[model samples]
Target: MERFTPTRYTLTCVASGREFEDEGWTLDDPECGEPSLVRARYAERQLNVRDDAYGIYRFCDWLPIRRTLRGSHAPVTYKSRKLAEYLGLENLYITFSGYFPEVGARMTTCSFKETEAYNVCARRAEGEERVLVVASAGNTARAFAKVCSDNRIPLLLSVPEDNIGALWFEEPLDPCVKLIAPCCGGDYFDAIHLSNLALSSPRCYAEGGAKNVARRDGMGTTVLSAATAIGEIPDYYFQAVGSGTGAIAAWEANLRLIEDGRFGNKLMRLMVSQNAPFTPMYDAWRAGSREMLPYDADQARADAEAIDAKVLSNRKPPYSLHGGLYDALVATDGDVLVATNEEAREARRLFEELEGVDIYSAAGVALATLIRAVREGRVERDKIVMLNVTGGGEERFRRERGNRVWNLRPHRVFPLDADKEQVVRAVEELFA
Candidate 1:
């Protein structure tokens, strides 16, 4: 039997509308100064689902990668009868992207960020060997560490010391992965700043945050999975946003599904939520502006610390960027909702009681926002709704997996205000 090879796709700038070959891990177009996010353009317009394939690979035709990773882990969607009844909604689909074995969600990192890590690593593997550097509060680092380690891909992760607790894994750490934490009182943004300084070397490459087309399309699989499970696109898509990249991915995926002509033409209303006190995107959307208003740094840090969902505290998100969260919201006529820490806690308890599974704090914020939307009549009870539980199943996973989180210590921990020379030296030593 001949091996089935997926067609290679081209990268097109969302701003200039110019196309480029998928020669390597390209993030931006040099020709356009304000280049928008790049998208994968495949020759196959209609999605050809491979029933024989597992997880997100089933939608390989849409993803940019030439091959699929060797994992069945992907977002699993199912009709939520219990939660729907509790919220008084007739049609509610839950896309769980965590370690819920009952629903077939096997993301051991317990976050949808795993989807991005797998796709990004696969895309970069096609090119010359180079170490990938990532900065995260917690979940993203864990996701990348797991995927890169499993694939034997070299990776360096920078995270805040406070968030180091969230970097546990079910299995032992791979030798190919290196970790760095800043001991000085810092936040996620500070970690990103340190990572940027470290990436000055030619051998190190940034994971490209929202700028990376592979990461966005990889995350788009959640929408595809939900649509496939529900047999059609939902009327509304709900998620808790830090960078709003996932929401943007859903909008992009919805556009592709609509182009397929199999799904309904209606665009899914993007109803994204942010934890309160640090709701930059929410404030911008409420004010009818694309630009995020300047926020006090100290106050922002305090707000971020106060929230249970520390992952949703990105101060410098891709909200105002071209073809970013702003464009996505405008294109889909989306609304940003805010959830307080108290509300998120209450919602988490309710969801655990009703759904019989523990959800991450960020997912709790999303659930609270959905309930608020239903109460405010922003979303009709009968309309099809897809709620993205971006992370969950940590407690259940610990119970089943013997609470064995990888305890590999960091290669080094730098001060919060580390100089550029210090960061460069650390990167050099990491490779040496």
Candidate 2:
């Protein structure tokens, strides 16, 4: 077995600015009563891109983990010519996190969520052997499943049965990965509910949603890669939000870049988008309120079902939490845009036609917002822009890899409203 040393870093309370050693795997400051994010303060203040490492690990100086899972897998950033011209933009750049072989984007899961899954597992792998538990609408569960399976790390994924079709993979599923689906009619939130119940077991640990620093920092690499590829910080950053984790990650990454003294000083104007009818963050932000009001469960579920991007339907997002999406948006002077299902569909078609690669529906929402921003003069044509196509290449991936059911059937399926005792029994049986 190859033992790896932990990275040199400290955990700093985002609210108090107090620092502590990387004592263990932690999500929150136990000492602080208020909710706050704990950021990793790396020893290296200056970033020198390591050309020797593969993919996102090249920035391992900033990543929480010291070990490298070198595959040609990482987000690829490039200047857009045809798409830029079509959109009538001068300096449009796209950071694609998918299986676009032409540009060397080899995210086998075809989602930026892979970045979060990889780092979260790697960080925990350095510590004890707790089974990771995660809940998602679709993309995230698949990403976690793929990365955990590839690394031979144990993980339990809970997803709504409606979204289980999205969990297919190109390669055969590893036995280490266990998946549970809620057969009872449930959305993403119900999956989360079941996952929370499942976490009651001592052997299982929550993946800490957006509160996990490793997940945030891992996704932040998209911004870092784009800044390095563009040779400067972009004036505008665009991405579609579910829990707004990626946008928060982008903001955090830009902050580090600004501190590095090489990238431009100004923060990129964050232009995050959400699918319409189910836009909690957008409504809250537009109301100029940090707090998000809860939506009626039935209404939210119906709206989420109607949307083209079901993955962007997080009900209880980490918006108002300290050092979260609200703070990130305020720091960047960001604005949230809403994209209707029709708009997102059109945008997806346009992007695929012009960019020569199929994009995820959430990416279409982001692209639609970019178009809206351009029309509203929120973003100037000449300003440097980084559009994060968070996920894509599903059609291409399926075409090339064929429809081989990796794990032909899920490990188990349970009701969304299953009791704690039932969940615990299922977990015990699976692990036993």
Candidate 3:
């Protein structure tokens, strides 16, 4: 059997409509004047699940990767009886991406970011000399660090110092994986800026955030799992977003499923949420603006600091980009919702009590919005709904692992305004 084979797919720029082949990590078409995401056009029109494969690769038919790696886990979807009854809806389902062994969700990182990590790393060409740089809040750093370490892929992660606690791993990472961070008081956007400066090195390439086709397609597997489990696409899809990348991925998956002719031909209305005080996307959507209104930098940082869900703290998200969350919302008749810290906490407690699993702050935000939608009569009781538990089973996973878990300490720390040349030179030396 061939260990490596190219996925039969072509790439299309969402802005220019230019079609091209995958170059492993192509984020956009430079020929197009406007910045936009490039989407994958798979040759396999029908969704095909490969039984021989494991983890996210089970739905590899739609992913943009030349190979699959070890220790990958797919999202698990199950009908929600307890939560469904509590919410008074008949067709409610939970698509979970974490370490709930009872449901067979074996993501040790205990975050849906594993979905993005696995696919993105796999999309890189084998033995590529360039070191991949990624910016993250915390969960994403943990996910990418683990995946790249496991697969022996060279990677550099820039994470917010405040959210560094989220980087605990099941074991020590390989030397090929390195971690860095903006000093305390910085946020996700700061981490992104640090990584951007590091990208100035010719030896480094960016693992594009929302712009990465591999990442969006990777996250799309959550919808694929739900559709395959429920036998059709749900009437609505719910999740919490910092970048709104997962929601866009869900919408893209819905399009592919509709084209597959197996799942029901309907686009699931994306019901995405954001943590209160840091809700730029929600604010933009509600104000009916294509562009994000001027948000003071100090105010944005202050608001981000006030939110419990620190991971949902991207001040500059892909909301206004072509084929981004804005287009996704408009195309699917979606609505952006906001949840307060108090509301999200209550929702988390309720979910754990009813569903018997702890979830991340972002998942709590998602559940809180679903509750709000129910109370506001935005969602009907009888409609099929999928509530995405982006991350859960953390307490349980950690408890089980015990002393085996280790935190990924940063190799270097920089002030928010660190010089670009300084960052680039230091980053290059790590791989040198």
Judging by lDDT against the true structure, name the best candidate.
3
Model 2 per-residue lDDT tens digits across residues 1-432: 234455678898888888887656788887878888888888888786766345667777788885765453668899999989987899999999988989888887889988888787778755567789999999988888888877777888988888887888777778878878777467899889888988999999899988888899999999988999999999999999999999988998998999999988989999999999889999999889989976899898888888889999999998998898999999989889999989999999999999999999999999999988888888899999999999998888878867555642567788756899998899878987
lDDT of 1: 0.87
Per-candidate Cα lDDT values, in order, are 0.87, 0.86, 0.91
Candidate 2 regions with alpha-carbon error over 4 angstroms:
1-5, 70-72, 405-408
Query: What TM-score against the true fold does each predicted structure earn?
Result: 0.96, 0.96, 0.98
Model 3, range 1-432, lDDT digits (tens) per residue? 235566889989898899997766788887878868889999999987865346799888899998888989999999999999999989999999998988888898999999999999888888798889999989998999999898888899999888899989888899999988999889888999999999999999999888888899999999999999999999999999999999999999999999999998999999999999999999999999989888888898889899999999999999898899999999999999999999999999999999999999999999999998998899999999999999999999877766468888889999988999999888988888
* Per-prediction backbone clash count: 0, 0, 0
Q: What is the C-alpha RMSD of each candidate to the true structure, in Å?
A: 1.6, 1.9, 1.3
The digit string of per-residue lDDT tens for model 1 on 105-162 reads: 8887889998898888767755647789999989999999888888788898998887
Q: Score residue 95 of candidate 2 by CA lDDT.
A: 99
The candidate with the higher TM-score, 2 or 3, is 3
Name the weakest run of 10 consecutive residues (lDDT summed) in model 1.
1-10
The global Cα lDDT (0 to 1) of model 3 is 0.91
List where candidate 3 sits over 4 angstroms from the true fold: 1-4
